[model samples]
Target: MEYSFRIQLVAIVSLMLVFPNTQGWGEDGHTIVCSIAQARLSNTAAEKVKELLPPGNDLASMCSWADHVKFYLPWSSALHYIDTPDNLCTYQYERDCKDQNGEKGRCVAGAINNYTTQLLNHGTDNSYNLTQALMFLAHFMGDIHQPLHVGFTSDRGGNSINVHWYTRKQNLHHCWDANIIETAEERFYDSNIDEFIDAIQQNITKTWSSQVEGWETCNSNETTCPDIYASEDIKAACQWAYKGVSDGSVLEDDYFLSRLPIVNLRLAQGGVRLAATLNRIFG
Candidate 1:
């Protein structure tokens, strides 16, 4: 009887370990890390973006460009968590420990460094290299815009904070990543990317200069930049934390209303800024 009980116990333990529930692993808000990349190519924008490609015998370039952009989507989203050392993978976590300078140690900053080096290596004949550069520029700009990506060391940017979202057990980190954006996306325009972008661009164009300044100011304190997390109250954070949010809460229906507008304005700034960087590099 004792031997049979031991065998059963071992089997149960193995089963539990193998089939551990992952539903709650990332249930809070979206990380804002990988989601930034998803914003790049909506189903609506794919055809439009393809239309912008150069003509005649450039099939390889076009395909390469598409793949390059797609590749960065995951990185763009993942890079948001780079600043938070605790949230990083074990390998990255150890690497961060070696850097005494806080900013230099940050994953996002490291990604920036890596990206710069990659951008400077001019030997590659990959036709999609330019697109890769542009996509990186766009996605990184958005990543930095999200404050939660620059989270604290203690809580791993709210990853440890147990919370509830509409009766379902959740955490703070996943909430920002999905609930907020998903809510907004569903509530706002008919899930149209171009329209979303147009609306967001129109809304932020007049004040984008100030918005950039605000992000710069928030990021000025290197020690604090990586320690902050988005607030529990998504509506309030959108309203108070960012310059564009006038009301305390953004209605679910109105979420996409501002997304593309914001993306468009950011892209415009990124393109111009990227051009300036290139001019300096090649001048």
Candidate 2:
């Protein structure tokens, strides 16, 4: 029994070391986006999601599958983010949408487009793994909305920038990915993820209602427009995420309070747009 316990503990530690900090939004953020989307899904999309998801699993439950599986599917690592030119704060698909080896169409935006195309072939195509496609689309929609995911190349989307979240040591990327959202929950939502999600959902239908339609709009009959999403993300990355703060800086109440709204808005947009894309594909 003692030997078995040690082996199990070692395995757990090894896994943690391998995936120290998740690239996209932490589990809570992805869950928030997906839960909001599931509620807004059209009947057709809902039914299709039901069919594709494993028994007893819903869309929100599986929204973070891509983040976990990326370790096994090493090819998927680059699909989670796009590293723009350092300090440029601009994104152009042709120039910025490639993997480290210079392979085009390998960035998060391109992954969205590819998966959108694959999911569009549902019911008629057996060549693509539509289950994987659906999950990828759902997840990438959330990823594209995370400003730091479309952040500066040098910092690897803030992952390399050492910062303090209040008094705790943290990387800038992780701060945007999880700390900010977690802090908001503790401070305002009773530390309940569901409440945080509900707050964003309420804003979606009320505060951001006017902008929801535009956020869901795809130009020129396209199924999904990731380029536009990417453009918006980089701008936000510069304006909100990368604005004011530097290496070893401590981000406290002031930073958290101001950026919380941007975080909320992005989560809202991610959910609204995920529902829209699923509707278009499965409608």
Best by TM-score: 2
Q: Which ten residues in a row have the lowest lDDT in candidate 2?
A: 5-14
For model 1, how does the per-residue alpha-carbon lDDT over 104-215 read when each residue is reduced to its tens digit? 4335444444444555553463432433443343334334334444454555545565655445565555544444444544556564534544444454346564664343
Per-candidate clash tally? 23, 0
lDDT of each: 0.37, 0.88
- Residues 75-160, candidate 2: write the lDDT tens digits: 99999999999888899999999999999999999999999999898878777877778888999999999999999999999999
- What TM-score number comes out for model 2? 0.92
Query: Where is the poorest 10-residue window by lDDT in model 1?
Result: 22-31
TM-score on alpha carbons, each prediction = 0.43, 0.92
lDDT of 1 at 255: 42
- RMSD, one per candidate, in order: 14.5, 5.8
List runs of model 2 lying over 4 Å from the truth.
1-21
Q: Which RMSD does model 2 reach against the true structure?
A: 5.8
